[model samples]
Structures are given as structure tokens and as C-alpha cells.
Target: MKLSCTECGQGRSITDPVWRCECGGLLQVEQRLGELDGEKLRRVFDERLAHRNTPYASGVWRYKELIHPELPVERIVTKYEGNTGLYDSEPVRRFTGVRDLRLKAQSENPSGSFKDNGMTVAVSQGAWLGYERFACSSTGNTSSSLAMYAALSGKASYVFVPEEGVAGGKVLQTAAYGARMIRFKGTYDDGICFLERHAAELGLYVCNSMNPFRIEGQKSIVYEIAQALNWMLPDWIVLPGGALSNGSALGKGLQDMLATGLISRMPRVAVVQAEGASPFHRMIERGLKELTPEPRPHTLASALNIGNPPSWKKAAAVLQATCGVTVSVTDEEIMEAKAVIDRAGIGCEPASAASAAGLRKLVARGIVDKDETAVCLLTGHMLKDTDALQRYVTREAADAGMPVSSALELEQVKERM
Candidate 1:
């Protein structure tokens, strides 16, 4: 496999540990396609899925041919990262006014977030390269995933996050997994700069989406969605955009599927971001080539509180190819959507609820047809940031029209006391 720069088109072999191009552009895993033996792939994938007891059955590794297939099985580090369920969420559908909206509950992954899908492959590649240490800068989910996978692969792990920025659940998970945790007194983008300065000198493998392999691993989400639908493509795929890595991967994955005849049509992709951290949405709406990132993005959904997303260029290009658009949502809307999703018994993090909130916005704007089949990607579990949830259902978000039953429960408890 070869890594190609999105800007200058410079190519390098996968053996190179470099994450970016000489021109400081993001590198993409340049993909090539050949005639796929559809029957054989389908049979083998179905057979492996039927077994479900081995690593080969993992939703990610089962599509290895589409990913990096050259690695030996022993070099693969997996906890069956994919294999999430497609939850038919009636509450979300009613709230968003989308008749066939299904929530793809990625929280079922081993790490309670979608980051595990990419981390498994990234750590596996590091193992193949005989790397002893891996590193990443994250808000929360990525650190937790990297820590867990690095531990399983017997590799040292280092994580950098904003001081007092990340959720305790993720920080605790990383520390419990024996990773060296470093807290920087800055934002995630600042942490990225910090890691870049130290990664090469320290001989650490930086495993952010800036590394194309992480995007490659995320492509499995597309494959799993198609497989779950029996190779039928949805009309739209709505997901929350933080660094825009998943959006970039979804567009490229769709192109690959189209080339391989796995799906006959294209799905319009929609990436939703919190209003405070919506550089991509701003650029798209303003028709600009680039954006000045938010100086200090603030949102209750901590995961989406990114100022400068590394994958912005790649994400823009892919969204253009697929006729996609970016949408922004407010914290109030996100919590209200979260409450509805929770009422449906399909819980997700506040950031993950952006899809539902944005869907409502898009539908109101007539950008998304309420009748079209749509699938929303829920990227993290509700427990990923429970403090925000509690604040909403208990105190600060009371005027935001949160579920009445939760407030009623508090009243009942007070009366009982």
C-alpha cells in the first residue's frame, strides 16, 4: 500500500512512519481497485460472520481484503471492533421527521466508542512494523481506544489530552489500561502540535486520523452498514463531525463500494457539527477554500468541541464528490435529541446526538427529504459524558424542555424525603 498526499500528490511506501507530506498536507492511503469476486467475498464474509467466534469474524478484519490484507493473523490486534447493531429508533425518527431513520449504535464496540474500529487496525500495523510504543492526542474516546488496544498488543501507549477537558470515563479508562497520560493546558489541536513535536524524537507511532490508516480502519463502518442492509445503500448517512475523519472515510468507502459493484447508487452524506466547533460547516456555507478554526470552541458535547480538524481538506473533497453538505447544531438541540434517543432506549453521547438534531434542522431547511431512508451514526456511548447528561436532566438544562418524567422523578423524591 502507498500513502499519497492530498495536496501535492507525493507518494510514500507504508513502511514510512511519516504522518504528513513535505508540504504539510494530510496523507491519504491511495487506494486502487481491481475486479472484485463478489460471490466469493459474500460467501466468505457470511461464513465468517456465522462462526462469530474468531478474530476473522470481526466486522473489521472480515473485510481485510478491502483493508490491509498483507499482515499475518498473529500481527493483527482485534477485539471484534465492528459488528454494531442497527437500532430502528422510532423516537429519533419521529423527532427528526425521517420515516426510516435507524441509529447505527457504534457504542457496542469494545471501547464504547467508534474509535476502537480504527485503533485496532492502527495498532495492528504498528505491531507489524515492530513498533513498541504508540501515541495519540484525543478529547477522550481515541485515548481510551488506543490505550486498550495498545495494552492488548503489548505495546507502550502515550496519550495527550486537554487538561480538565476530557471526560473522566475516558481518562480513567486510559490510566486503568496502563497508558502514560499527559495532560496539556490547551485544546486538542494544541495537543496535536505537542505530539507532533515529540513523536519523531520519542520514536512513537502517532495514531490520529492525520494518519491515513485510521481512516482506512473507519471504512469498515461503511462496509458493515452495507452488509447489515444486505448491500442496499441508504439515501443518506448522517453522522457527527468532530475532526471530519469519519465523513472522509464514508465518502471514499462509498466510492470503493460503487467501483466494486457492492452498491449501485451513491448516498448523500451529511456531517453535523456543534455550532461552536463548526469550521467545516462555516467553510461549506460560505463557499471558502479554507477556514480560520474557532479560537476556543465551546459545546456541552465535548467530543465535538474541536477547533481545527486535521481531516478538513479530505473531508471537503469527499463530501463534494458525494453531493454532501455540513450542518451545525446547538447544545440545546443536542440534549433534547439525546433525551429523545434515550427515551427510545437507544442511548448515545451528546456529540452523537448531533446527527438527530442536525437531521431535524436539515429537514426543516428541506435539504434532506423526510421520506428518504437515512441511517444516523451514533459514534459514542451515553456514558462517555454522563455529567453533561445529568446536568441536562437534573439542573441547568431544565428550561431546555428536557423530559418531564426526569424532573418529576426528582420532585417525587423530594416529596418522599
Candidate 2:
């Protein structure tokens, strides 16, 4: 249960709340791989379920042993955020030219975003570490999710979001959870900088990408994917990247499962980002092996509008280990991909759609074969930013607006057109 700095080799106890090493590198979990008896771990985890079996119901708890220690489990409020559906995607398969396609629909989680997976674990760890207050800088989803979980964990939550980010439904959701919502005039980048410089004095736990527990929770998604596929690894895992912690966690989780003999092969990880805010993509274009986060990233996919992601080094390690590739899609293409996914019965945020857009790009470039098995990680629900989505959808539906209530009437209008 000890953690280590990947860059400096400085070891620390897992209970410490330190965010980074003296070398200014992200701290990574460094667990001993003793001949891990997977069955034994499962048995112990199952026994602990008697207290509140619901934690084991989904997400991190389902793969509890991978990240959690053998110590007493802390109680925190989570919406049982993980273990989202591994939905079969025929449309995605056809579109991406990947014959076997599945979607890890994290958007179905309580807060309509994959950040819940991180928030739940971070909140649990905070409660365990005697922290009573939580805070983060988010575009939208993470702030709202952390606030909701903090409320359940008897912790005060503070969220700092950009003034523009507050335009979506996210601001209301965060406020509704009774979190201290601070709006910044700038983007998420400014908020992150402000939080980092001020967090210690404010006595607030910076629960953004720096917190190890969030990535630990995110690792559960890979475990769930393996379990859903009967422990078979996919050829690729596609997901949108902002802070890149989730992508990093996927690589680590897969490695953990491989070590434990839970799966046989490792998957190639693919990160998708909007073209307007693609620092990772720019790094690739420059023949750089890692992403050096910019200072003012902006995009229609607000969740991915991060300038300087704290976990950039860890993310580089992840891509290196997984032989991953990063792709960038234009905002227009992401919007089109969103419409396509929605037509396929999977409504998603722009960031989530970026994953599918990446797949399409891969197919166009003749990189991914039509028969390859791929999994698109849909990170957020479309409803998370309802106001923007409403404008988008309503503007498209303007032609059919005259007192059309029934489905038949809508169809009739379409037929007329």
C-alpha cells in the first residue's frame, strides 16, 4: 500500500495526502505484486460486502483489491458510479470499421460523467484521511460530481469553474448540491492555477488530477470492461482525454490485471481530444513522446478545455506502456459524431463523441482494421450540458415546431419535408 514518485523513486505511505514528489512529478501507486491470490482477494472483498454491499455494486468497489488496501474501508457517498454498461455497438462498429465494438457508457453514471468514478474514491479516501473539506477546479462534470459525493460523505465541497463553463447545466447542478461554487472570469486553466496556489491555505483538498485516489477509482473502468468481456482484452480502448489521468489509469489497471492473471493481453490505448484544444495532438505532431500541457486550451468540449493537465507525465508513461496513439477531432466533427452516436441511441457529450470521432479518423487513415475489436469510452451524458444541447437540438428542430406533440405528427412533418 505504498506509493512512489515515478520520476524520483521517492516512496511514501499511501495514507499521505501529498500530491507530488520533490521532483514535481505525479505520485503513482506502487503496490507490491506478491503472488496475489486473486481468489483470496475476491473472497475478502465479498466478506466485507456485508456491511454495505452496495459499494461493491459497481465501479471501484468491484475491483476493490486492485486499488484499495486491506485496511478498513471508509464510508463515503458514491452513486455506485462504476460498472457502467459495456454496451454492444453495431453502429460504432460499422462507423469505425471495427467489427467488434463496445461502449463503456460512463455517461450513465449519477452525475452524467466519468468523473463520478474518481470523485467517489477520492471522497472515500478523504474521509479516511481525516479530511473534512473537498475542492476542485473543473469545467463542469467533476465539480458537480465531487459536490454530490462530498455532501454524502459529510464533507464541505468547494468548486471553481470558469464563468463560461457556468453557462451549461453544470453550474446549477453543482450549486444544487450546496457546494461553494466559485466562478472565475477565465477558463478552467485559470481556475486550476488559482486552486493550486491557494488550496493549502484554504484547507481544501485539491481533488483534480493530482489526487491519486481519483485515478485509482478510474482504474475500475478497465476492470469492469475485462469482466464484462469475460476477462478478454480489447484491441483498443478509445476515450477522450483532458487531464489524461483516466487514460493513465487504464494502462495501469490493465497491467495490474495482467499481473494477477485476470486478463491475458494488454490493449492499445487511444486518446481523443478536440482539435481546438489538442495539446496532446500537438505534441505528437512535433515528434514529442509526451504532452506538455498548454496554458490556455479552449474548445466546444468544455470538459477537455484543460490547459495544463497535472498528470501529463503519468499520462505519457501510460501511452508509452500501452503503445497508445492520440488523435484530435475538430469541433465540427465532434458535433457530427455526437449526432451520429445519438442516432445510434447513445447520447453523449462532445468529449465523449471525440472518441468515436477518433475511431473514424483511424479508419480513414487505414490504421484500424474493419474487424478489430474496439471499445469507445463514452465519458459523459449529453444531458450534463442541457442548456447548450437544448440550443443545439432546438435549433435543428425549428422546422417542425408548430404544435407538433404526437410522434405521428413529427413523422408526418418529416414525410412532408
Candidate 3:
């Protein structure tokens, strides 16, 4: 595989210690898959479902040839990440008005978030490069996943997060995994800017989605979804847009599958950003060629509060390639969707609920057909951000005027019931 600049079309060796091209464009991995047999590969992937081995056991590594064909098995650092569940929830289907809606619960991964899928590949690639330290700037999930994987791989980890707005559970999880936490009184975009400026000087291997290796690993999410559907393509793939890395990765993976004859059609990607932090959405709505960053992005979905996403260019390309749509939803809409998912016993973090809310909007607007098959990706587990849940419940209770009342006697309780 070779690293290719998204803008300048410059090619560089994969061993280069650079995240971006000299022109400051993001780098993407260009893999060389020699004459892949779709049917044979499908059978092999199906058989590996029961392999119980090192690489195949991991959902990301199960499709190693497509992910990182050059990486050796002995150098892999995996926690058997991926293998997350896909559920058909009646409430979610009804809420979105999509009859064939499948919720891809990525929260079931090792780190309670989809970040583990990318972290395994990124950390393994860093280890292969003989790096002893790894680092990333995150809102929550990325830091937690990085810390966990770094601890497992015996590498030092450094996490930079905004001083405020991050969920308590994510901070606790990162600390528990023994990462050196660094907080700044700014946004996640600020933290990422700082890291981009000083990561090389500090000799840190950045494992954020900006790292092409991370995107390579995350592509497995698409692979797993397709494999679960017996190699059939979905009509739409809905996901929350934060850094835009997941959507970009999904688009790339789908293209790869199509080129290799694993699938025949492309799924229209629908990326949902928080209304307060919807630069990409605005760009699409205004018919702009470039994104204008939100100066002070605010959202109840902490993970989607990034103002300037680094992967916007890649995401834009994906949207263009797949006839994708971008939309923004209010915090109220996000919370309402969260409640629906929670009531259905398929809980997700606030950010993850954005997909459902966005899908609902798309369906209402006639952008997405209710009869078409769609897979909504829930990025993180509900427990990842208990603070958001607490606030949501408290506000809901206040708005509804006390959902419960004290009952001193059994008669009173019975009467209330």
C-alpha cells in the first residue's frame, strides 16, 4: 500500500512519518489488491467467523487483505475489536419510518465505542513502526479507546481533550487505562491544532482519524455490515458526523468492495451533524465548494461538538462519490431520538442517536424512502456518557412536571399506579 495525497495526487511510501502531504492535504491509503475473487473471499470471510484464531478472530483483522495486506500477523495488536451486533429494533424502525432499518450497534466493541475498530489497526501500525508512544486529541471516545489499546500494547499514551464539556465516564475510562491526560481550555479543534503542531517534536505517533491507518481499520465496519447481510448492499448508511472520519472511511470501504466485485451497488451515505456544529451540513445546503468552520460550536452531543473537522475534505469526496446527503439536527431532536432508542432497550450515547434523528428528518423530507433498507451506525455505548443521560432525564422530568412522586403508603402507590 502507498500513501496518496487527496489533493495534490502525490504518492509517498507508507513508511513515511507524515499524516498530511506537503500541500497540507490529508493522505489516504491506496492498497494494491491483486485480482480478488469475490465469491471465494466471501466464503473465506464466512468461514473465519468460526476460526477463533488471532487475526481472523478480530473483525478488523478478519479482512486483513483489504485492510493492511502488508502488515505481518506477529506485529498485529488486536483486542478482537469489532464483531458488533446489528439489531432490528421495532421502535427505531417506526421512529425513522424506515421499515428495513437495522441499527449497527458499534458500542458493543471492546472499548464501548467504534473507536476500538480503528485503534487496533492504528496502534498496531505504530508498534510496527517501532514507536513507543502514541497520542491523540479527542472529545471522548477516541481518547478512551486509545488509552485502553495503549495500555494493552505496553505503549505510553497521551490524550488531549477540552477542559470542559467532555463526559465524566469517558474521562474516568481514559484515566483508568493509565493515559497521561492533558486538558486545555478550548475546543477539540484547538486540541487537534496543538497536536498537529507539536506531535512530531514530542516524538508522538498520532492515532487520530487523520492517521490513514485509523481510517483503514475503521473500514471494517462497512465490511462487517455487508458480511452480515450476505454481501447485499444497503440502500442507505446513516451515521453521526463528528470528525467526519467514519463517514469518509465508510465511503472508501464501499468503493473498495465494489471495485473488488464484493458488492454491485453503492449505498447513499447520510451524515448527521449537530445543528450547532454543522459546517459540513451548511456547505452542502449552500452549494459551497469548501466548508466554513463553525466558530463556537455547541451541542448536547459532546462528541459532535467539533467546529473544524479535519476530515471534511475526505468526507466531501465521499459524499460526491456516493450521492450522499448531510443534515443537521437540534439537541432536542437528538435527545428525543435517544429516548426512543433507550425505551427500545438499545441505548446509545447522545451523539450516536443523531443518526436516528437524522434518518427521521430525511424520511420526513422525502430524501430517503421508508421502504428502502438502511443501516444506522450507533458509534458509542450509552454508558460512555452518563452525564448527558442524567441531564436529559432531569430536563425531561422538569418539563413533564415530575414523572414520579413520593408515596408513603401502599394505598397511595396503588392509587398513583
Best-fitting candidate, measured by lDDT? Answer: 3
Cα lDDT for residue 154, candidate 3: 95
By TM-score, the better pick of 2 and 3 is: 3
**Which pairs of residues collide in model 1?**
none
TM-score of each: 0.94, 0.91, 0.97
Q: How many angstroms is residue 115 displaced in model 3 relative to the true structure, after the best TM-score fit?
A: 0.8
Residues 1-417, candidate 3: write the lDDT tens digits: 799999999999988868899899999999765477788888888888996867789999999989998899998998899999999999889999988999999999988999998899999999899999999999899999999999999999999989877888999999999999998899898988888999999999999889999999999999999999988978999999999999989999998999888999999999999999999999999999988999789998989989999999999999999999999999999999999999999899999999999999999999999889899999999998899999888988888766467758997777656
Root-mean-square deviation per candidate:
3.1, 3.0, 1.5
**Alpha-carbon lDDT of model 2:** 0.79
What are the Cα lDDT values of the candidates? 0.87, 0.79, 0.92
Lowest summed-lDDT stretch of 10 residues in model 2? 44-53
Q: Rank candidates, TM-score, best first.
A: 3, 1, 2
Cα lDDT tens digits for candidate 1, 37-155: 66667677777787566778788998887777676877789998899999887778989998898889998899899998888888998878889999999999999999999999889
Using lDDT, rank the candidates from best to worst.
3, 1, 2
Candidate that scores best on TM-score: 3
